[model samples]
Target: MPSTRRRPPRQRHPELERDFVRTPALGYEDVDGSGLVRCLAHGFPSPLVRWHFHDEYELHLITHTSGRAFVGDWIGPFEPGHLVLCGPRLPHNWISFDVPEAGAPERDLVILFNHDPIARAAEQIPEMREVLQLLDRARHGIEFFDMAEAARMHWEAVRGARGMRRFAAFCDLLCDLSECTDYRLLSAVQMQGVQAEAQVDQINEVVNRIMARVNEPLSLAGVAAELGMSESRFSRFFRRATGNSFTEFVSRVRINSACHLLMQTDCFIADICFQVGFSNLANFNRRFLEIKGMTPSEFRRQAESRFGAG
Candidate 1:
């Protein structure tokens, strides 16, 4: 089993880089809505959060919102001043609510770039050899606090450059990241292998069902029935295919939906709970604390603190 971060979604052909090169996911383009973005740039409304992971290491320089960020098994609060570096293939998401505007764009700048270029550059430069090592760890992800400025400086360079210069600037940014000692890896990559003959595109139909009825009560049995599969078979099929069980997988996905609400609205937890499919307050609290490892209030407090300094 290869250990470096690379998982071709079922819709894509792993052997064909071009097939996965395009933003393969529906709605959430690898880039974004404009399509002109060489890198993805999205500014979500205060409440529009999505809990999703991808095949690339992502740098999220958050400004003007504070909330809990769930990366793998680690969860903590962050704010306008947060730097969330998500590892490739980890099931993670960030939750924020209407962050008070801080004279910057309301939507945070989410920059996505492929790891291959860094791999290419390191082969030619000894200065970046260590950086390559860091990236291998980054397959699990990393996070920095009070460090977006350092990253912002790098990002500004990348965002402003033109032609090959832009590409070079981005390379330099990776080197800069490699040099930082304060960074934390989310965890060593613990991803499962994709089945060689798995029918991923067909399964998206199931994923689509979850996405559409996320807020409503959804059961694995019902979903399987809708998909014309037997309950027991669907259970086994989902687990083998996704590296996740239907219940836990659905909960992970629901948490992601909750994150969007947390960042975009002033709605109370109870309301947000219902909005994300939990009907009881105790259950919501239990799940949030278990999944996020912080009480919602504590999570909020930490986020505010992080943003306060920013």
Candidate 2:
């Protein structure tokens, strides 16, 4: 007998293409009556995914396919069973690159929940502080390298349960993730002032400037003028807020951009240097070596060996 079940229609949401501004917050509804947590499993050919953020902590499992995973300012490879925990308002997306003859199957197992309820629970119960601490680490986003199957089982349990049973399963999943020691932080550094709107705006302004005009020379004085602050005040404020000085932050961002170019293009080393904001090849080489521990040519070689060129 042929199966007659029809798949649900795909849902679409706004996504950030290159702009790192605030991603749209997707509101989840309790259509089936599970209010505190929302679990969803879906498939797509080439899903309408994008770099986005929300106020909910997301435990995302890549159940199928492979591609690049973008979280915060990090971009790396991902495959099936890739499990990551994203803290509230952390920008993230997973883009699949597989092209199967049968089309890509269901790819994501996602669970989203708010931290306030958990925080309230933790305050009432002393032991739940560990979970709160886990949430803090999630601010940088966490990619679990071990216990993939266990996390999947917990996700399934939560997806299948209802009422208090669902909540209990969710709690168990968080406990398991919190206890797991084999994980890596995805972002090079976590974004600061997640809850402070003005601080986040300043960071975004700087980030947007760097990413958009990576080829142009960046100066603290110019940035300060653009933001209407004195250079000294801006320097102090940016360092305190983001844990990186203005110049250091710009160079880091430029280097990261150069890394992507190295892996994705066949451009000449010196041209790549000028294209990523360095004034001269020597300075570019020096900065790249200091930050990446390799010269531009060497970095390109490694990237080619790892990803097999664009």
Candidate 3:
């Protein structure tokens, strides 16, 4: 049986902190170097486990333990073989529950690479363009399922090889991720292109306000009037810019905040409901079920597994 001891508490970092900034380890000269691709392995209690974002894309794989994963506005469970691709500047973190007091020596295998080089190379290399779509989807944080063994094998190939061989192995891994269909987009909303810069600014202001004041009441009519547009027009503009209706986007934001509290604190569900701006408990439960496919209590119960045995 797995140990039921609770793991030590980790220091919570601010949501927007741009942590883990460093130059990529260029492996072109060394026989065992990773070149443009930076490969990293670390344990659960290590400094690498934090809520932060970076300028490069990250391919993350779980090799041990179960825990809650926070990716952008998405929150869910992760176990061995779980894999995700996070685009540049998209914040993410994984907290393992099953770690022992001494800690597991290895919990994650990661690959970090930048998009500029690839995008530039694709301008001349048509074959490399296949990964462009994969990178775009990664902007919303892509979670791939049922490919753990293959991912580990590919990571090993890249880790052991160097120079052209290493690059080839990395490309092979990207090709597989690109073709994979058994995956889900983690973020609740995606930002599509808008018509004008002013429109983008207006919408961004509204979005910033919504996120900043998630606990406050937000009505489309009020926001539309503030933006000097009719409710109908604002609805169209909001949906186009955010891929979700105004109300739906607000609900997702609140629910996302509630999820963070659920995983990180022992607050009662009813208390959390009000804390996140829901006026009633039933409405909060319904919305949580609708979005997370679980009741708040059940979500917390499952989240406890991240600490190991329940």
Off by over 4 Å in 3: 1-32, 40-56, 62-81, 87-109, 114-140, 145-157, 168-172, 175-182, 193-199, 307-309
Off by over 4 Å in 2: 1-30, 46-48, 190-310
* lDDT per residue (tens digit) for residues 27-136 in model 2: 22344576688776665443335556788888998888887676765567889889999988876777777747786657877888889988998888887777976898
Off by over 4 Å in 1: 1-38, 46-48, 98-105, 188-310
* TM-score order of candidates, top first: 3, 2, 1
- TM-score of candidate 2 on Cα atoms, chains taken together: 0.59
Question: Candidate 1's error at 274, in angstroms?
Answer: 30
Using all chains and alpha carbons, the TM-scores for the candidates as numbered come to 0.48, 0.59, 0.66
Question: lDDT rank, highest first?
Answer: 3, 2, 1
Better of 1 and 3 by lDDT: 3
Q: List, residue by residue over 163-244, the lDDT tens digit for candidate 1.
A: 6777677767776676777866553222243445446654667777877888888998898888889999999888876678
Q: Which numbered prediction scores highest in TM-score against the true structure?
A: 3
Model 1, 9: alpha-carbon shift in Å?
23
Per-model CA lDDT versus the true structure? 0.61, 0.74, 0.82
